[model samples]
Target: MGQNLANHLVPSQDYDLICENLAQTKEGADILRLKGGIPLANLETVTPQLKRLKIGAVLNGKELAAIGKILRSTSEIRRFFKEITTPEVPLPTLNQLLIRLESLPELTKVLNLSLEDDGYVRDEASPLLRSLRRQISGTEDEIRQRLVSFTKGSQAKYLTNAVVTMRDDRYVIPVKTEYKKHFGGMVHDQSASGATVFVEPKAIVELNNRLRQQQAKEHEEILRVLRELSQEVAPYTEEIDQNMRILGQLDFVNAKARYAADLKATQPELSAENDIYLRQVWHPLLDAKKAVKNDLAIGKDYKAIVITGPNTGGKTITLKTLGLIQLMGQSGLFIPAGEHSRIGVFTEIFADIGDEQSIEQSLSTFSSHMVNIVEILKHVDDKSLVLFDELGAGTDPQEGAALAISILDAVGAKGSYVVATTHYPELKAYGFERPETINASMEFDVETLQPTYRLLLGIPGRSNALEISLRLGLDTMVVEAARQLTSQSSQDLNEMIADLVEKRHTAEEEAISLNKYLTEAEKLHNDLRKAYNNFVSQRDSLLNQAKAKANEIVENTRKQTADVISDLHKMQQSAGNGVKENELIDAKTRLNKLEQPIHLQKNKVLQRAKAKKIFKEGDEVLVKSYGQRGTLMKKAGNHVWEVQIGILKMKLDEADLEKIAEEKPQKTVNRASVKRSRSVRTSASLDLRGKRYEEAMNEVDRYIDEAIMAGFPSVTIIHGKGTGALRKGITEYLQSNRVVKHFEYAPPNAGGNGATIVSFK
Candidate 1:
């Protein structure tokens, strides 16, 4: 699908990789092996064809290869297929392959190829064919049995081996060179050493005649059968060829889809109304585990982005990713990016991206770049994507910056999406001046003095030439002298840009820190909520249990009271109102004692647990059961105090807080240090075996989240060997996950390779 601009948009190396991933069958491979892009319309039929192929099981490689050969013209297949013999692909294979072709169903159904000998026309192809084969079988058997008897009787000693062997398709026996005249009817062949002769016995000569006659008749019958089958097939050869062509196209499409799957690539959102917005986009040509992700936006805000950074900070590579991803997307190939990445279909993509200064072309670097740019301008339109690397580089700085800005303006006037990279400070300043253009920078770590490879949008980059020179053993006097030579405005601008870069870095670091803490706080909050609910539930359950037991005791006490009262009443009745007052007093006392213990137990169980200790602002307090420390901001009405820890704030119950001695207070967790600590104890992989699908994925999600937050470049997942359901589920999850860049099966010796190694962005 991407044959036209491929040469310009992708390097030769990357083009080869894309083609390699797009080929399956030899025909498909041959088609992909071509250097140029095919028209997009040519790929339209591929979808339905692919859906058809996808419904069937994977075809055998040999069978697929053979079938692919049928679509090749005789001239194209000449090197591999000689004119002397035609490949007699069995009818069954052809029929099996063409099972879905409506026109050839009848021919395919009646074609019996089960008894075909190695794809050759079968002896049971027809009744006449079967009769001819029967005669041959009978005659051959008679010859073999007679020969076996002869060898066993006396000729066994003369033969090299006792079994009958075929020479020139005729049964023969190996006899000693000296004894050849005695045993042979006709010497069919001789050994290279002249030590043995393969001969037909005189006794079996007549039998050989009969077998040869039958074989001749069988050959004729086979030809007749073949002719009959060929006649039936000839009428539908066009349809058969068409089906093969469709199959090959499907194979190519499937190969691309499979490759995308392997690379964890996604079909980016296609937006015709907007310019490109690539989120966490990575170059498919680079190693997924190592490639840094970048967020890029062109249009909807600015039509062009001028990226600047140190050499090899991916300034050039960024240009290439944008160009290649556009080409890939328009070509119906998935891009290596996160979901929600939007790419507009470019009518044309023109790239002057690499150092095309050709000595052989007798052109200087600037001339070559200008030459390509001139050509690019001629064809660029509103629907085009233009990529330029170090625009106007091989020239004077003043002229180059002016030229670059002008080129961007010209391309922008065409309404084309434009991206260019340059180190010129003047160009960086121009980015601020232009209303339709913005500046982006590749981040560099000041502490490690290395490239972080993170692309920061909306900030210009400063050339760290002075700082780098000073750090790399340059004399302070020389650096100061160089600084003095530069204008005050230039120096001031450089300082401002450097400060901005540093501040941006700090801001990003703070964000990551905030994220980590928020996650921890959330987890802690959930745990606390769970524990509190459990405590309340258990308390209520215990209270219910206690009240139930008390009720039962009260019921027994009431029964006793009733019995006492009844006895009193009986006494009154029996004694005519002369009941015993002592018995009634004793019964009431027993009832009072039973009710007293219940009141005391109820008072103990139902007591309110409010804080007695006073806590105020600036106090270091521990959130009980949370194992976290926070500073009290203020008391919020009745016993609820607001606590602050870093960016986290919450109102906690008085009982949930315990004032802690400021000495040896709960230390704040350092996110960077937490990330670095993975070097100490974290294993590179997480194993999820024998867990249910939901349970396994839940654990996998947490494991991956922790790994990402820990700043792991990559990690492994061991889901054990099974029916591949677990691996598939995990893979799908990874594909949709924001943290995962890409994933692959682990190498051997790391549990089953069904266990995948995941990379994080």
Candidate 2:
């Protein structure tokens, strides 16, 4: 089925849709951990049987069994897909197909109970069939006993061989031809040589007749059973046929997916424009272990690529790879290319690949190629992909090069994308001379005298004939002589190409080094940012704790003072003249002085220090040690100042601080203000319980971003175990998230399957 699907091309209008569906099916298979469903090996086409039933033809037991097997498999498949195709892990395209599959419980159950695996009707199928078989068994046993007795009797000598067998559904014994009349009641058969005759003994003739009658009755009962099963299937002929068709379609889709997985292929991004970009793509037919990968792109900035190089340098392979992958993409199959590879849908694909010489037609290689090129030019358009291998070859070099240029010109003018491979150096010049064409080549190693098979785009190929000869033990004098005979213009072009290749190699190496350094710098920046956030969090936590403790102490002192005053008033009331009101007021004034909050005195001291240019809280000071400005928090100890700078907190000696500016007025802390401050603080866990899938994902994304920014090593997402939609969605999201290093279900005590612990990179 996969081969059949691959052999044909899908229409361009439906191509992208088909590819998208196939990609979704592959994703569904991955999520389910089953390729498509149960092994389709047991699935057999039952369309013919269904057709027979539709025409009122009775289906045998085997045909019915085949149909039953399909029905059962369809049910299993429907159930399997339903297990994972929830709101969280939605597979819309595949789900549409699943929706059409109807389970036939009654029909399947009846077929399974009535027929055996090998298509024979079971005795349990009906009581009458069982009784008939039993009677037949009993008569057959009696007939065999009587025959054995005859074999052991006095007339046993007449038997040619003392064995009983059946001829024409009747029990018979082999007898010597001369004694046939002595032993037989009836001659059933005679041997080929006329030496023996098979005789039915007259002694058990009536028993044999009874056994035959019983056997006929059994046959009638079996047919009746088969007919009943067929009638049961007749009503479901349309449904059964539909089920088979759906299963075939699903199997075909799954086969493409399995092929993609096995090949480690990725879904290519289809584009509206006729631009191609294949990254690290190799020929699918080649041994991936040994095949060299190359990147090629065209049809965007340039409409054609003229690949010029010596024979066996993989120029042909490059052409074939591009052409084949294009077709594969259009056929709705994932291509054997790296991720992010982009392909365009072409209305037509023309290839003049390989040798096309014809003997019967008396056409030369050049004529054969010309015939193909002429045909290609007729229909080539902007949406067409044209490939010409060894174009204009087997002819004069100058004329062939000119013809190749003209053909490329014609094709490019038509706005068609063309890739042509040739050995003509003139075409290399043509690639440079033309505006919409680029030069490309396969790398050759002069030292190894072998092609590296690495494609270098934007650089023309060098023959390196002299260099190769020198490396292969040719004398230096002869090599130098050969090089001297070459035209200086040709030598200059090769030299320029060599220089460009070498420079490109050097640039690539430097780019790799720069990228490495850039990555290291980014890592360092992230580490510093995380450290700052952590410090800020701890600082704020400690500050809040200290403020709460201070507030508690002030409250306790206030309560004590109130209680003391009440005691004093009660004593005055009791003592009357013993304690005067004036004295009581004076004592209360002293107590009031002591009852003042500590912060009030500290504020007075701060005011007095400010008059003398002394640093205090609310003063912005620059720390000499870090050369960064910070707000003065408080005095930590003698001559030590605690300061807050961005996310960092530190204690520095007064001598290290320089007053930079005065701080602004502090705002009164309120409930809303505290809540706003706490909102930015990252926590070790987030609760998403009872949230919808989209809502949960939004929270997850925001939470993870904050977690990474705050430098949390890992955070738990509490989605809770309900329908598992949220959990599955979160897991999949994390898998594709660039920042998330890994994620897994939390431990049993920590929400178990209900939560995921996500660790960031």
Candidate 3:
């Protein structure tokens, strides 16, 4: 179970990363060491194949000694010599290859080659190689001949019908004998009063000695090569190991991400805000194959949710889904959610789910639950997400409901978010009375007498057990008699139960219809938003083009006018000094004509006022240097006015303001206008909103400029305190700003510090 669970938790590809992170954690470190894969890169190369071999074989003394010798000799002899002789440092290409041979594919191939190939070539040049090869071959041939000769001699005798010799110990053979004389040539150990005899033949004994000598020599050679190779490759060993480790980590991370995505049933879009937001979320483990998807909304509005439903519903699954998703998210995996889903960082996640009762400890279900709850209560604060499956369910319903409500109230008061599942009716009623609590239920189909597995919000379910039993063919007379024996209040409760069932069913149908509508509406909304954005972008582009065209026309007109003036001045100079009075008048006339247009142009400039007092209270104005606009709320001075925009309040001079309208009465500040103005101002100071790449950069630039100009020691710009756009925008901007001394999110005390505080140089 552990291995299988590990397989799901850490993918083979991501094993390295999991191992590295595991190495960092106390538990992971222990597992990694126990697995004997340290510096996980090197360990990983061996683990896959190592898993296949017997543990005893891999860890045996002979094998270890052999491996050690190979590594030492290869680096010291082969690699060192190559490196010193080469122009550049020689890399152990072959050595690296050998190290990688520990992988399954390579090891399998090596074993196959060793077994299939005789590889008995005698080296003619080197006497040692030749002698070793000859000795090995000769011993093998002599052993074969002697075994055949012994068997033939034994068959001729009457002691046995046939004889066979088999290798047992290193130099010993078991010989089944038909003749007694052949056994005299070899030392024999009788088995069970000489029914079978073990023989130590001279040829076999000499073969063992030769084999040992050859093995030792081969071992020495391999060790020499391995040592040299290790040295040559030593530089890149760390890097390779690191890469392998990273690869392992990535594999596990990717798997976790994929699982989260699958569990979420949708892809979560990457964002900079760390706040988690989900709309209509369903529990992934709630028999999703058969269960109806529940719509759960969380994050922005209700940070904590209390779910109430009848017994045998899917409350536990809901808790598990939430807990699992959070775990997946923190491990740096993608979550399963809509593109708009935003998940935040949590310090810890505690769950009190499943039947935790322990008979050995003399604890009842309630006591067990209480113990777990107490542990959770002690550790949880804001920034932690708590899940309780069937909180306070095993004790008396009245007291249990009270305990549950109190626990929820306490957690909520601490500002920590929680989600708990319960079946207590009073607890469900409590949801209505409490402002922070919301009611939800797992639906049951009355007609079919089965759980629909659909979750409905804003409503609670009553146990439909009696109704279901009746529907399932229980005797009507028995049911009627039982109903008669019940109290009037109980009958009335049953009637109410019937009504709620009808309402719940209706709600379930309506919810399905609504979800279909919502899906369609969401798609349409997305399309419309895209089109609107495209139109705005195109309009901006066209506007820029028009401005460029207008500038070109104005420049052309100015150049033409200058040329005409120059020509007129030249003509006036060329006129002779002794000309007739009429000619002199004509020359003066031409001069006057040329100068007239110049005077007209100068008058046009003078027609406009040098300064216009267009500023008014409640008027929206654009600051020239600043990219944002604000509304004028009060007059501060002859040239200074106070503006209230979005979350920003500032004072600006009239010279820096331009009225949005040329000729209009001051309009009342509508909510939308105020919102737009606020959005504009917020945009200027690193809008930590849902901004992306280039858009964020622009905001950062504006923020730095504003911070520097305002001479603020430190000023905070609100970014919604999410994990997405705002935070990313601020960090990226801070990276390059020359004037920024430092910037970070404000401390928790100041509005929970969802804003970024920047100090300028």
Candidate 4:
């Protein structure tokens, strides 16, 4: 099926649509590769049954089963497409083919219930059929039982064998001819030996007759079921037929996709300007690993290319590669070419390839070729791609070269795209002289005496006849004699071509080296960009945290100050004349404690200083200037150490270095131990809304210590705004505490003033 579809060629006017289908095919192949594979192996074409159904013809069980299998495949394929399609890469073309497809589960269910896997109607297809079969089975069982009883009874002596058998669908027993009258039953059949005659006893004959009648009824029931099923299918004949066609088209597309993947081929782009460009294109039929790839382009810069080279140097292969690739593209199959290859749609493609000599017509090779060329000349126009191999070869060199040149000119005059291969040096010169024409060659390795099969555009191939002879150990005298006999103009032309080949080789090497460097540079640029973005993101996060902490501390301090002043005024009003000494002393003590937080705030640098610890080389330490951890390289000077952070190296004061310990795997803990230390693992917030003032203060103290140990940046204390007593108390405590860097209310959405958020130093 795949081969048949691949061999088909669509019309030129449908080239765009064909290309679209090829693109869709390639996409489907890629998805199938990722999604395990397509589940279309069991999908059989039911076109025949579908046609029968279209004409309202009754189909048998097998035919219906075939159509059922196709419906099952349709559902599977549709589900596959739906599952794999994504917004990022939707299969627009493939999904379009499924627009009319539906999951008619009821119809599918009915068919599946009625038929077996091989298309035979099941006994349970209908209640009447089931009942009829059951009756037929029971009657056969009764007949067999009656015959068995006879074999065991006194009448068994008349039987030649005690086995019961059937003759023409009725049960009977074999009896000796002499005892046949004793059996007293109808003779159904006689054995090969006349001594035995098969007959049914009178007693079971009635049972056999009843069984036969039941079987006949069973047959009628099966036929009636099949006819009903066919009628059920008739209503949907047009839809089912359309579905079969769509399924076949999808299968064809999938096959092409699979073949393309095997070839590692790419779909060709439609050239808007009749231009052809194929890079690293190889003959599709040739082994890709062994076949040398080449670039072939024409129609854009030049209307024609004249490839001249020695025989068996891949010149003919080049012509075929171009023509075959173009044809494959037109047929909606991917070509064996590199990505970005473009192909022009041609109204006609003419080829005069290989030997076409005719013994019957007595025509020479040249004449035969002329006949093909004449036909091409008459039909070719600006939209045709013409390929000729060994053009103008089977004749005198002088006449052949001139004739090849004239033919090329004639084709070019028509503006038709042409590619031809020849071995004539005159044609090489003619290529350079002609307008809209270029000369190309198949590369040859002179030392190895083998063709490299590399096509070199803008250069003519050299005939290394003398070089080959010398390499084969031909006498130097012969080679020198031949070289001396060569014309000076020919000698000059060969030398010029050799020099050009050498220059092109050097230039290609340089281009390859430059491309390698460019790739590395681009990769480095991307790495640097990513690293810069990460650095900026980390820096912003840390700065925001620090700013929030500072603002909270300032706001809490102001609130605490206002509360203390209010308390002092109330105390004075209650005392009237004077406050007690103890009470006055208590107030002074509270005021003195407040000074500690102020001192810490003033000496922030001292508060942030790390404990003294000896540092050594290879130890990880935090670089204060960069706020990043780095490996300690060495001591640069007294109280100075050099650190390596990422790719940067820096020397900083020892005071800036804070040694960081390497983390080790922790030992497994017991659940009981975790519960015992629950207070040590404090949460980010505490609730003090219902607690007494004294108890709440104590809880706040313990929670703050736990939060600090847990490395919490800030914690919320939920003290209801009611009575303003708890809020005022917590704020005053936070303000006087040296470790409390900040305290403030959370946002309105998060408990607002009822919650006090605290940050530790």
Candidate 5:
């Protein structure tokens, strides 16, 4: 079933996320890990070519191992060449001398001696030296050419043997031995093996020998560097492994998301929530360009919505939309809907949207649907979403309606949500009678004699077939005759249906008008609130200024009165010869004049009271630290109020709380903030050792943001020594950050070049 779905389905964003998440699990890790494998360090060298091939999946661990082994061998050859080179000779200079020797007309002349007279015999000398001397003399050129061809051919064969591409789950790599022309390569021990090919010509063997000697010397230096690098990286090997695993998982997830999108034939909004909801959703398979948008709300109201409409309406399309969206949602992809739409989690989405007739089972269309329903019944639960399109259409009206009702009842009993489209009038009436059932219909235009494709809730449509047929050129007389032969009750029913249609239209228009009025009212309310807040703020500021001025005047008066009293006491003391009562009285009057009474007017007190009236208890409010939603429990003694919020109790003043309506929910904390908190608590930030220069730089940017938000004054980013790519990336991110104060590579005891210590401003 999985394979079948994969084949038929198109990739979607949700699928990609699923695949990636799945790849992160134990199973995915197992797929990438192999025994007796070449180290991943070697594999890094071949990643560029692998990326060029666009190969994303771990086809087999062995294949990756093989590639790693080849790279390791190449590394060894490079080391060997470096080791043989002379220490005194500069690599470039030595390479230049070798090139000149090869360009000479004769090696014997270039060497300033004949090979025959030299202590070295042709065969006794190094094969590389013999080839180089012969080639320099322009002798044995043909032999050198043949050797080059052989080496090139062998190398090509070896690579071909190592790599294979799969098509339709079968490996395709054409391999052959020199003896077999048609049989491809003879499989030995179930694995293809081939000889190593050296493309360099044998006539240039002498040049190769000299080069090898120079390389040997260089190899020792390279080995030393490698040893140091390995030690630097050893501490971070685990971290690098983790990153590779994560990248692999992401690759898988991306692929799945793409596939799901294609299968649903729609783009779904991506979210990381547990529920799915969509409003005004359309069927992807339907010609949305021509199809109407139908508003469907699932997950909260009636589990089973029975849609009843006239023939050729949009009942089936609605069913398909519901099913497709569920499939897309479960796959972790987004669906097309209004921004406010949400989806709920469902374990399974069982759909019977189209005919499932099977001749082999001797089942008619009705029987086929029944069979499918039976299958659904066995597995149906609260976590399952079921959709039945045109249920009971192929069977007798009375029996089918009864059957459909029973099926819906059973499904509801199982606690599963079901949406079934039907044409049975009995079923429609049943929907009206049931509390959990809702009746919906597609609107048809009587004047135009066409389906409007608009779905109406709480209504059932009448079959306007005969009337439409007549309008479409059928004889009016025939339609009239047919109507006459119908029972009186039936005729009354048709008239009642017409009356209901008119009322529905009127109701719809009134609903639209009401919405418009509500919108305008809301806008007015907001404007008034803003104006009131501004008025209150200005009033408070003005009152504060007035109070300050009053205090200043009072202080000045007190100072003047104190100075006058001191002068009065001095005068009394000086007039000790004969101090009259009238003179003392005059001194007191002067003091009284200096100290004028300070009293606030009644209007000032009223203004203060008015300013204090803006805040009240029991109001839903927003606090800075609590984000956008907190409840004001009660006002404390003076201005403080105690509030309860999400396991936190805070005592805040009126100035700290901003009133917010209860209707709107608060925005969630940012994901980066959450990750930062976790990192701080766990002390596990990203380790960029062994990563590419670009990757390390990206990690550095992410880490800095996280560290700052986590309240870390400083952090250590480990960037192991390997060409300094990781170090460079860390330094670059640090330099660009406004928050970063400075950074430096750690000292040897701390981590050396293998880590960087970043200080945050």
Candidate 6:
């Protein structure tokens, strides 16, 4: 979009809504100006630093937000402090400056006392400022004590109420109307009913006088403090101003993000290819819930599309959606479209949309449109997006259609993308006559007599005048007569359009029915597949249960046979000559037969174990408990192995030895790729030579994780001990990492306090 396009879009429906939203996020006028300012001349060459400020607050013994607001305002600061007395340096306008400095940091090196998130300078800028505040607090306490004593004394009788209230910054008591003369002090104010008077008693007059004196001193001291703060700020006025500008830019950017979120917008791919392919794009100006999303393509084969439709059928809105979204993209705002949408960088965008005629300039609608089109044609190029509405509709139909065609040809010759809306029948044929243009229309329901607002491409629209007239109760004879009066060719074209719309509508219904059936079939297929899987799982579970029971029975039978054989042997030994050798042999044979099944089961279990066993005599494995890698020397026993780790052979459980995949030869990496990877790597060491405190702290987190993953025994972080902030932050982070066994400052021979060495567990 061109620089001039914003003005055209600002007047379009809801386009300015975006600008208003951007204005709301800004905190101050300085930022608003920066957001509204003209584009930079050359962004590539601009390296100006953004202005920034650190602030602290002065608590006046309250947590009231209103008081905080007053304290933060530039106008309030100026009113309270009055003017600086010293003539050494001139201060900037106080009403625009947020703070006034009285003493330099040399008197008190303090800054960054946050009062609020929007950011305001705290009153405690220096040590002198803090000291003066303390004195004020003490004086206020004394005054409160004096007022309490007086209210409890003889004056308690005259006092309408014992409560003390302040009037014009002076501690006052409410006295009864009849006893006003008894109080030998000035009356400040009276109640609305005049039933009582607020007075400062003469008895505490001396205390009040002392309090006043202290306040005067406080005021003077505050002015001095503000002047000192102002002096510090004066040196960096440029930086402060720039900070405001950058903050405002960010505020606007954030607003756009919020607006895009509301619209469910996606970021569009940008290109200089001079093509636009939009999908599921809804007009931001229209109600998104009801809006019919449409697809539009331009600068691909065709340079222009002539859209025609009945009145109020959304041709104009489609044009506006195209124009507005393009402007939004060029201005760095997200477009409300699908991820497939792409936008080309156009140097200029021209629009003759709506009725932009100027009566004050004595330009009729046609003349006004022509004047805009002439300017557009003179400057439009292959990189421009030009739009027109109701093109050539305010003049004679024949001449207007001719002129519209001529203009489309001109734009096409220049290779610029153009979209125009028209109601002229002759103009509808222009799209067919020109190879670089196509026709589109908004769909309308013939039966409901309502516009669908659905843009249908590759289709020309009909006027539908006769049908509307007939529906409005016009004489059927007159409507029929009007249709017959039109040329045969025109009548034939209208008949063809009617037939085409009917066929498309029927096809759409059939397609919808077919889709519904397909969806149902797919659901049924998924359900059957899920049922089959469940059946297979149940069958496997039952089979495993049966196999377990059979094994249990075989073990029990073998145990019984062994016990019986043992008893028989005992009996035979005791009864010396009673049993024959054959009978004893038969008993042993029976025992062997019972034990065969147990032996076969045992052999099957051994075979399965042998199938899964990973370690061999020569295979290398890692001993996790000892954190060492070694080869398996031999198999010691069931579920255990003898492994040699670092020349020491020990019997270990198989679970203790983890199988390590043999390392493959490292793939050769190009020298350039190695350098690139290193530049982006956070390895066993991190060097924060010149980074800020925040950046250095963040980098430390990534550095530690990389070192642990790389299996480094120890890692070093170099954060030069400048003011010790960076070093302190890095050390604190290192302490939080669970992987670190210990960390300490490097020795003097190394980087000393400038670097920390950490050992990982």
lDDT of 1 by residue, 139-210 (tens): 888898988976786778887767788787788888888888887599999999999889988988888888
What's the residue-level lDDT of 506 in candidate 1?
Answer: 61
lDDT of 1: 0.67
Candidate 5 deviation (Cα RMSD): 30.0
Q: Lowest-scoring 10 consecutive residues by lDDT in candidate 2?
A: 669-678
| TM-scores, all models, native as reference | 0.52, 0.62, 0.44, 0.66, 0.40, 0.51
Model 2 residue 146 CA deviation in Å: 2.3
What ranges in model 4 sit over 4 Å off?
Answer: 1-13, 87-89, 148-165, 173-184, 191-197, 444-454, 472-474, 484-761
Across 221-314, the per-residue lDDT of candidate 3 in tens digits comes to 4444334333433333333333333334433433343344345444333222334544445555554355455445455546666776666677
> Looking at candidate 5, what is the lDDT of residue 301?
47
Task: Score each candidate by Cα lDDT.
Answer: 0.67, 0.78, 0.55, 0.78, 0.56, 0.65
TM-score computed on alpha carbons, candidate 1:
0.52
* Cα RMSD, each candidate: 28.1, 21.2, 29.5, 14.2, 30.0, 26.2
Across 578-609, the per-residue lDDT of candidate 2 in tens digits comes to 55333343345445444333333547777675
The candidate that achieves the highest TM-score relative to the unseen native structure: 4
Off by over 4 Å in 1: 1-103, 112-118, 160-163, 469-761
CA shift of 470, model 3, Å: 10
